[model samples]
Target: MADLWVGNVDDNTSDDEIREFLIKYGFPSFDEIERYSGTGTRPAVMLIFHDTTPDALRGLQSRIHNMFWKDRTIVVQVMPERDES
Candidate 1:
C-alpha cells in the first residue's frame, strides 16, 4: 500500500475538497480526514492512505507544489515501507 501527502492544509478545507482533488487527479482515497493538534484553530493536516499509486503521487506532487497551504507551503513527503526484520 502507498500514501500521498496533503499537508499545510487550511482547517477550513473540507474533506470533500480534498476528496474532489484526489478523484480529479485519479487518486481514490478511502480514509477519513485528519486534523492537526498543536496549531490551535488554523493548523496543518495530512491525508493518509493505504495506497496512492506512484503515478498519482507524481501528479499530486506537481499540483501540491510549494503551497500546500495558501499562506505557506509545508514539507510534504511520501512514507516508504519500513522493512521489518
Candidate 2:
C-alpha cells in the first residue's frame, strides 16, 4: 500500500479530475483520493492505493511528478508511513 502525495494542485481541481488523470495514466482504480486545502494556499491531493507493490508506487510517482495541471507543476512523492507513537 502507498499514499501518493501531489502538492501545489490548483484549488479549482476536483477529485473527479484527479481520478480521470490517474485513469489516463494507467491506474486501474484508486482506493481513495483526498484533497487538503487551507486559506490562501494551494490545495494538495493524496492518492491512496491498497496492497500495492513498491515498484508500482514508484512508477506512479514518476509518472505524475512534474506533470502540469492548471498551469502548476505537480509535485508527486511517496508519502512516508506515519509512526504509531
Best by TM-score: 2
Q: lDDT (CA) for every model shown?
A: 0.59, 0.78
lDDT (tens digit, per residue) of candidate 1 on 34-82: 6775555446556666565555566566655564444656555555644
Error of 1 at 58 (Å): 4.0
State in Å the error of residue 83, model 2.
5.6
- Candidate 2 residue 2 Cα shift, in angstroms, is 1.0
Can you give the TM-score per candidate against the true fold? 0.58, 0.78
Q: Report the C-alpha displacement of residue 28, candidate 1, in angstroms.
A: 2.5
Runs in model 1 with CA error above 4 Å? 53-56, 67-75, 82-85
TM-score of 1: 0.58
Please provide the root mean square deviation of candidate 1 (C-alpha atoms, Å): 3.5
